[model samples]
Target: MSGPRTIWRSIATGLGALALLVCAASANTASAQAPPPDIGFDQNLGAQLPLDLKFQDENGETVELKSYFGKKPVVLMPVYYKCPMLCGLELNGLVRCLRGLNMSIGMTAEKDFEILTYSIDHREKPALATQKRRQYLAAYDCPAANDGWHFLTGDEESIKKLNEVIGFRTQYDEITGQYAHAAGLVVCTPDGMLSRYLYGVEFEPKDLRLAVVESSEGKVGGLSEHILLYCFRYDPASGKYGLAIMNFLRAGGVLTLLILGTAITMMLRKERGMMESHRLLEGSTHG
Candidate 1:
C-alpha cells in the first residue's frame, strides 16, 4: 500500500486536477460561444436620440423627440405595430412586467415616466397605432392612462432616423412576412438622451425601475436601486442584451469549488501530519 503521506498528496492532487479540468471545459465552451455586441449606455448615452425625428401619435398629432425631453423618461420601442410574433410577445411582456410595478407612468402624482411604442414600419398607419394602443390598454390593468402610455406611428423619414439613432436594425423579411429584429426596450432620459437598453422580451421590473430612476438622475423615487447593480446588462459579442447568467454562474461555481478544495486540502494535510506524529512517537518510545 502507498504511504499515508503519499495517499494524502494523491487525493489532493487528484481533486485539484479534476477542478482544473472542469474549469478548462467551461472556458472552452464559453470561448466557442462568443457573446453579442455591446449596445449598452455610456457617458454619451442619449446623444443618439434623433431630435428631428417626428412621428404622429394615435391621434395624428405630430410629436418630436425634443418635445419629450425634460418631461418624463421615455421607454421607447421600435416595433412594427403589425408584427405577428416577437413584437406582440415583447409588448405583452412589457405590459405584464409594468402591471406589477408600483410606479405609474402618469398617475404617481409626479408624472415619473411614460411609454412610447414607435412603429418602425413607415407604412403603418395611425389607425394601427390606435388599434394596438386600444388592445394593449384594454388589457392593461393600470388606471392612469392620462400620463402613462402612448402608441405612435410615423412616416418613413422619421422612422428611419429614429431607428438609426437607436441602433434598431429591422428588416422586412418577405419570406416570413415579418420584420426580422431583436426584441428589446430602450430607456431614454427625459431630455431625450438614450440611457439604458433592456434587451429581450421578459425584463425584470427592478431593472426597468433603475433605468428610469438613473435616467432621471434620482428625480424619481419610491423604488430601490439595488436591482440595477446585478440586473441584466449588455453583452457586445451577441449584439443583443440578455440576462447575465454565465457570469454569475461561473463566479459562483468557481468560488464554491475553491472553498471546498481548500477545506479538503487542509483536512488531508492535518490528517497526514497526525499520522506522521503518531509513527514518530511510537518509534521514539520503542527506541
Candidate 2:
C-alpha cells in the first residue's frame, strides 16, 4: 500500500483514465488561489459541523447546513463541478459503487444514506451544479438519487469554514488552472457529526455499507451487520480498510458479558416464579 503523502498533478483526457504529469510550481509562478503543500484530508471523528452555514442547492434554493440533517447518515463529498479529470473519475467511482448496493439513496431500508456534493470552488454556480447533478444522475440511472443526492455551491467564506471543520485541504494549480485536492468521502451522522472518512476513488460496497451503518451508530442495520466492524477498520496510511486487531481482542469479552447477563436474567425469573407458587399454596391452606 502506498502512503497518503503521495501527491502530484494530472489531467484527465476523458472519463476512462487520468494522465499523471509531474508539474512543479515555482514560487513566483504560483497562483494566489493555489492551496498549500498539504492538499489532503485530515479526518476529525465526531466533529460537529457548522449547521448555520449557508449554500445554494441544485434547485437554486438557499439552505442551511441543518437542512440535510436529522434523517440519515450523510456522505459528504467536496468537488468542483467543472473539474476536468479528477472529480469526474471520483464521481464515476462513487456512482459505480452506489449502483452495486441494494440500498437506494432516497428510500429507507436496512441500509439508507444521503450524499452531499459541495463545490469547493466557490466560482461554480448553481446552474453548473444542476448540470453536473443531471449528468451524474442520468449516467447513474438511479432516479431515487435525485432526491437523496445534493449538489451545493457556497461562497468562498462558507466553503473555507466548512473545509476547516472537515480539515479538507485543497489548492489550485496555476499552471494547470485546476484545483489539487484529495479524493475521499466523509461519512457524517444524522446530527451533522463527522464519523468516518474513506479515502481513494474506488470504494468497496462492503466498506461503504459499513461506513454508513457505523456513522448512524448502528441505527440503520441489525446486529449481524456489525460483525464486519469487529474485524475490519479504516487504515489511514493505506487509505483502505483492513483487519481490526483491537476489536478482535475485545469481542470475546463482550460476548462473555452478554452470555452472563442472559443467564442472570433466567435465574431471577425462575426464583420469582417459585416464590409466587409458594404464596398461592399458603393462601389455599389458610382458606
After superposing candidate 1, which stretches have Cα over 4 Å from the reference? 1-46, 103-110, 226-287
lDDT of 2 at 33: 61
Model 1 TM-score (2 dp): 0.62
lDDT scores for all predictions? 0.74, 0.82
* Residue 67 accuracy (lDDT) in model 1: 67
Model 1: lDDT of residue 215: 72
What is the C-alpha lDDT profile of model 2 across 162-246, one tens digit per residue?
9999989988778887998999888899999998887888877777878888888878776666888778887756556788888
10 residues in a row with least lDDT, candidate 2: 7-16
Tell me how far the alpha carbon of residue 121 in candidate 2 is from the true structure, in angstroms, after superposition.
0.8
